[model samples]
Target: MAEKCANVNDSDCSPAKKVKLNDEDAIENTDERNTSENDATPETELNLSNFKVTKVLQNNCVRKSICIKGTFEDREGLAVVLLEQKSFPHDESILEKGFFDEKTLFRKHFTNDIYRNYDCFPTEEYNSIQTTVIYPATQNHIEKYKRHELYMIDETYELYQQVTLPYIESKSLSLEWITNILEHKAEQESIIYEDSDKDTGFVLITDFKWDKQLDTLKLLALPFQKIKSLRELNASHLPLLRNIRDAGTTAISKKFNIPASQLRIYFHYQPSYYYLHVHFCYLMFEAPGIYVAKAHLLSTVISNLELMSDYYTKAVLSYVVFKDSPLYEKFKSRGALETSTCETLDCK
Candidate 1:
């Protein structure tokens, strides 16, 4: 049962500009993608050939993963493609002529790009939130973590001031992308609901990964107020939480024709960014941050606030910290994690 393609190079299966539809980045590239041998995500179905590039939002060709975020012709959302450039195979580098020099390789393979003043020049510089997982959906990896490692974080006001506040203030995160979308500067079509409540107002937008598909629905609702993370929430912020759950969810369901019952609404404790936002995804869709370690149910947060005015302000939050996250080092230094090393968690 060994069928062979006459010219593998020309075959559809052959590696042709290997790219991936990264869930973290909210875009998809297809066919073949390069990855560290152990970590492989499920491949999504998207035909970028039909996509006509209108603008290059970001091109991080220098990072560990070379990615380019862009806008496509007639397409409303953003699309990110990780150009797998210089990761050339060793055998392919066995030059049959003059020895390979830096200049020769640069001339032959490197792609030159020009960035604007405000562009996310070296994409590695910014930190963004992500919810999907590409890891093999094995019962062991998923089920075991939920049973053993998941812990609820009770973030007391004192703990937040001592631990969380300092780390956020230290890292000057770039909020240019969020700011652009809110001010009608970018991804205007992706906007689902624009709450003009001022104090509790927010702009909800669909995830770029959806690509107009509703099967695996996704969205991000950014609050207009600079509330930072869930730790800042109290009963006073109930309007924001409830608005996201009700108005936001309703918009998604009505626009997409998806029922509200199928939606899973929640917020991330240690959100990828310093900005306060809510995540809405299909209940059947299990993204990376949906786990108890990170995701806090929107309804649960509402209920907790209703019970006590200062529930979140005085709660003892318990959440996971990856071995590689900057927060992990901060927590370890302050003895917040209860161990010098984190053996069970992932590497951020």
Candidate 2:
């Protein structure tokens, strides 16, 4: 059984403990073996020597691999390695089960500390280390939104059209932003992919905030249509998801040289802008707004629409709002929300 840390927020936990695995077992299980003194084969030792350890996690029995190291390889781009103690149990290893095997373990043990800064393993040799992007959602929060707040989404849609849509139309804002990107005024270096079409095309640009480290590829999908957020999504809008996923995945794969399975494509509710756009990020990069309260996987959205043509029309969606958000104010005014703090609202 995995042991729980007393306080995950604490910085001074005990150093990762070392245990002894049988030498024969270590040699036989090369794929699951750790890059430690006890388990490192000649080839593994040579390859890992090039990297330098940069971070360590202590007093975390559940975390066998606490040290993370990185170095730029001559041909392999950036190579990152997680150093694990040889004595840890192979059966209990999160990597052996799958990246998202246990939601609580993934969130509490894997996401909190040193792992946040390290890149997902650079090569198959380091596959024993797994990471995930989705945050764990509390059952209470999900149930509360489902029961009381989902209906407000419909009201929020009307508010968006009345207030936000006019501002966007008057300024011709998103179009101008796209023009700036094409003209090289913004995000020139970050343009990983572009599908130019005057009719139904879109551009994929790197988000300005992404640092490009740790597989944090934050690409924005700006569609040609001025559709405003998921509220505008319906059967007709479903095709946009396919086009963006197909094109975005291909481009990102070419750029990163990774399979499409390593990527996560989704959209956020109450996007910063009113324009309809999508987000393309690595599955291991925990970019903001990825919680269940706000993020909706594009694939799920498409399937929902396929099952019900007017899915968005009748479906109750849950979204989060900050205390000062105008949308939150709208819900509060209508007596749909009791508080202005960051809370989830359900809209139908």
Candidate 3:
């Protein structure tokens, strides 16, 4: 569930402070059998076994792990133990070498496999796999939006700074995934479209989405800088859009052995992420977010910006908000949307 940011200026908008654990209690609970040869005694051995199960995390159907509270002896502060389900039995050798040390554990465990899987597979092979299947929006969702306006241009950047930025900085989900893609997968896999240069401008990468089961190619045009949604775009970003379209068309067509005309390039108003990105999918595929109220075609966006420099900036664009969305409530408070009659769907 997403948390609502009541005020952007408040300290509540900042990342949540992590709780500190007592190190002495944790060290005292270390099992004697797990102690290293060099430090077998209680005084010498670093006790790590005194962990209290704080949370259980489940990833897909295949794996689950416990998040434990503890502190490493050598480390200055308290830490959390993310116990990953190992394929092999607990290895004492790893413990002796400090493999599960705070720093090492953080580096290894704090990542999503959905993003990391791109690194393991060849780009062509990865692109071919059907990883996601999105269901069409229900009548409930349709009716809820019917009463409320979708795009709140004025609130876009404010919501990003308050809600999105803090989550990325503290939770390290989308931000980390993006960093890994740029660092590990982009260049080697031909995913990079334009590297940010002083002359040409902002960095952009074009890559196929993990889900492409529709028997047609779908690509993503992601910008490196933090620009929240299409609402933030203006004439200044025209070059970036053009580059993305040109580069994306060439890359997708060549890789999939299809013509560029078959592709439909567009942008979603209320994107899943705050970062500005364009979507390129097969024209034949009735993609989930392509409706008039939700999607704005890239060609149209570019043309609009060209005609009026502050078109998006000043324009009152319409976009959908579900009955359950906090944004929906916000709109209701401002009387931008009528009180909804449709029931909120079980979103998760």
* Predicted model with the maximum TM-score: 1
Query: Which model is ahead, 1 or 3, in terms of lDDT?
Result: 1
Candidate 3's C-alpha runs over 4 A off are: 1-173, 185-214, 341-348
Q: Which digits, one per residue and each the tens of the lDDT, describe model 3 over residues 1-348?
A: 112211110001112111121111111000001211333466544345433333221121222222223345454443343332222214476443444334332223345756432222222312222221111222322232222223333344445455434543442113343544435432223242344433222223333222323343455655656576787788888887776676666655545655678888888766655556778777876545677667889999999999998787567666656554556655565555654344335444
- How would you encode candidate 2's per-residue C-alpha lDDT over 1-348 as one tens digit per residue? 344331111111112211111111111101111222443366443444344433332233443333232343422333333333332223446445433243223223346644553333322332443321101122222221121223224334455566445544553223455555545455444555565554446766666434334365566777776676686688887666777777777766665665678877887765554567788777877665676767888889899989988777666666655443445555667666666244456634
Give the higher-TM-score candidate: 1 or 2. Answer: 1
- TM-scores for candidates 1 onward, in order: 0.56, 0.49, 0.48
Q: After superposition, how far is residue 32 of candidate 3 from its true place, in Å?
A: 41
Which numbered prediction scores highest in lDDT against the true structure?
A: 1
- Report the Cα lDDT for residue 237, model 2: 71
All candidates: CA RMSD (Å): 19.3, 18.1, 18.5
The per-candidate count of clashes, in order, stands at 12, 6, 3
Pitting candidate 2 against candidate 3, the one with the higher lDDT is 2
Residue ranges of candidate 2 with Cα displaced over 4 Å? 1-176, 182-185, 340-348
lDDT minimum window of 10 residues, candidate 2: 24-33
